[model samples]
Target: MRELELKYGCNPNQKPARIYMDEGELPITVLNGKPGYINFMDALNSWQLVKALKKATGLPAAASFKHVSPAGAALGTPLTEVEKQIYFADGFDTSPIACAYIKARGADRLCSYGDWAALSDVCDEATARFLAMEVSDGIIAPGYTDEALAILKTKKKGNYNVVQIDPNYEPAPIETRHIYGITFQQGYNNFEINESLLDNIVTENKELPEAARHDLLLALLTLKYTQSNSVCYVKNGQTIGVGAGQQSRIHCTRLAGSKADNWMLRQHPKVLGLQFVDNIRRPNRDNAIDVYISDEYEDVLAEGVWQETFKVKPEPLTREEKKAWIAQMHGVSVGSDAFFPFGDNVERARKSGVEYIAQPGGSIRDDNVIETCNKYGIVMAFTGMRLFHH
Candidate 1:
């Protein structure tokens, strides 16, 4: 089929929606539910992200997307015991693709609620079982095993969106879109992120360790698909935080840094030991955990609202305790879609244990940025390639 009609556009009132290819048959086959415009948007963008991640790392990759930006992305890496607990995958028989998706969704559980999932590898029974437990709108992958397809077909009362795309399909070099009756076109962004981009070290601390290089590459590759004015914080093989579509660069850094802090705080011993009522759902637990880690925990306690979420009156994670815990966070890597105009971005990033940075490096305040990185013994690289996605 060359075109597929939709129930509606982004909004319900925006009628007469559909997707089509002018030159040839559409590359995707909808094997399950009918996906709306926004669902397809999320699916296609997220598919590109996972494909790039798998190509760069030579591992199964996955992404959770919302509003056309990735809430989380990850490569298939063995999950530690702690990771399994935090991701709520403790007893599941997780395959590599399952682990990748779990890590991606766990990066920011709050943001990934009702997200669209994408996978670089074909979906298998293990992956489908994991996806069945989550609150998601749809999924896109190259293919799915029979058992996997059967399992996914049962989700959302047989209305879950399952899409299969041809792995060999490639779009034209030039891409075009229309907004408000006007047309816009641009050459596709095909910049490959790899170790070569990390060579231009300008900070006093020029140590880009092998692990840091991998994380830097992960961050940069994520930024390549992220909306403009974006910053991503990554560690190990997954993104911990992503701040996208901000008007100010410093805000992006601060937003992403705070998210990174939250990810770290979740692993705190106090957070790990929190007791909840027997039947609280995962989403509620995530929200309660967020409140527990924030400064408002005392307020929650004072308001007598902790009883609804926790089994006992939990001790507030005091600001001092949070600070002490956060201080131990290290080896984080961060990437920016554009140049930093000031040093404040770096300053904010340092608070979240960011030790390595990558950016396009064309700002007039490059000296100040480097100075701030040096102050914290942080290593930075100027990849000289800006990644601005719409």
Candidate 2:
């Protein structure tokens, strides 16, 4: 179809919304449900992200997007037992694509609620079964198997939005948009992210191991599609944290670092052993886990909130325990969408176990940033290319 009508624009009060191509049919077909403008925005942007990840890593890729920013993104890597439990993959058939999607959504379960999912590979039954259990808005992929399509059709009371994009389709180099009756145009961002960008090591530690390089590349690719003023933290092929659209670079670093710290804290034995009430909803369990990992867990437990989620009132993860667990977190890789103007960003990232970093490196305080990395023995590279997505 040349154009697809939508119920409304970004908000329901807005009127007359549709998407069309000037000279050719749209590259996507809406297999089910009427997706709104924001859904399509998320779908298209997330599609590009997973596609690039697969190309860069030669592995299946997936992304969880909320409001055009990815909550998480990851390549298909076998899930460890702890990973499988925390990600809710236990007892489910774990295909490569399924593992990628699980890890992506698992990166930040709180932010992934009602997310738009994107997969690099065709949706198979294995992936569909897992998506069926999550709270999501819709999904986009190159294609879907017959059984997978049938399963997805049952989600969201049979009104879930499912889109299939042509894998071979490419947009024109120049892109345009309209705002307040004014036209804006620019060449599409086609800068490729690969291992080559990590060549310029700027720290005392010049060793960029193969696994660290892969993590760095994954972080950079994720930042490429994330909102500007963003930072992403990656480990073991999946994004552990992403802070997007923050005004201050330090804020972005701290926000992402906090999320990374939480990811590590969840793997603690106490957290893994928490027993939720029978049939507790996935979202509720996720909420409980978040609160349990935070400093407020003691307060919440005193208020008797655990009765709602857990069968037994679990002991709170103490501040000291959280600190010790986070200290053990190492080998993380971080990427920035733009240059870091201060070394403080590096210092904050180091607290979250960041051992490798990738940034454009155009800051006036480059020496200071390099010095900070040296203090931590962190390996950092100046990619010389900013990935500022709107």
Candidate 3:
């Protein structure tokens, strides 16, 4: 098709929206519902992210996108028993593509409430089954298996958006856009991220094992597609935390670090043992868990929100217990969209168990930043490339 119409633009009042190709026919086909302007924006950006991740790691990849940023991204990796439980993958040791989807969805469930999903490879029945259960807007991929297509057709009462893009399609080197009756042009930011970028170790501890390198690469790839003033924390082939569109670098660091810490805190013994009512919904459980992890639980519990979700009222997770559990978290990798002008970012990242970092090293206080990493025995690299996406 040459063009596709939309219900509206980004908002309800922004009327008369459509997407068309300026050169030739559009390369995307919608197999299901009509997608809006923001849906297309998220679909296209997330498609590029998973495509690059698959090429870099040679593994199937997936991303869960909300707004224009990714809530989470992951490569094909087997899920442990604990992971299966937390990701609602019980009783299904699904395919590799399915595993990737679960990890992507589990990154930050709260943010992915109505997300657009992207896959590196073809969608299969295993993956489709997982997606069918979530609260999502649509999905985009290269292709879909017959069984998967049949299953996805049942979601949202057959109105869910399903898109298929040309996997080999490439855009022009120079891109253009118009804003407020003015034209703007720039070269595409297609700089490749690979092992070579991880070669420049700038910390006292120069050891970056293969697994750490994979995590660093994953973080960088995620940051490349994220909004500017972003930071990502990745571990075990998946993104644990992503802070996007913040105005300050320190705020980004702290936001991502706190999410990373919460990811680990969920695995703590006290958290794992929390019992819910026999028929508590997944979304409700997710909300309860978030409140239970945060320090505000003492106040929330007093407000009587806990009694509705749990079988028996559970004690709040204490600050001491949370701190002790967080201390045990290590081997996490963090990536920044631009330079860290101060060592305070490193100090906060250390509190969340960050042991490896990747950021453009252009700050005037680079020495102090390196010194902070040295104090924590962290390994850091200067990629010399800034990834600032709008």
Best by TM-score: 2
Per-candidate RMSD, Å: 1.0, 0.7, 1.0
Highest lDDT against the true fold, candidate: 2
lDDT of 1 at 342: 98
Measured against the true structure, the TM-scores of the candidates, in listed sequence, are: 0.98, 0.99, 0.98
TM-score of 3: 0.98
Query: Candidate 2, residues 1-390: lDDT per residue as tens digits?
Result: 899889999998999999999989899999988899999999999999999999998999999999999999999999999999999889999999999999999999999999999999999999999999999999999999999999999999999999999999999999999899999999999888988899999999999899999999989999989997899999999999999999999998999999999899889999999998999899998998999998888999888878988888897788888888899989999999999998999999999999999999989899999999999899999999989988
Residue-pair clashes per candidate? 0, 0, 0
The superposed Cα distance between candidate 2 and the true structure at residue 365, in angstroms, equals 0.3
Candidate 1, residues 43-72, lDDT tens digits: the string is 999999999888887889999999999999
- For model 2, give the RMSD to the true fold: 0.7
Give the alpha carbon lDDT tens digit for every residue of 245-296 in model 3: 9999999999888888888988887788899988877788888899999989
Q: Give each model's whole-structure lDDT.
A: 0.93, 0.94, 0.92
Q: Which runs of model 3 end up more than 4 angstroms from their true locations?
A: none
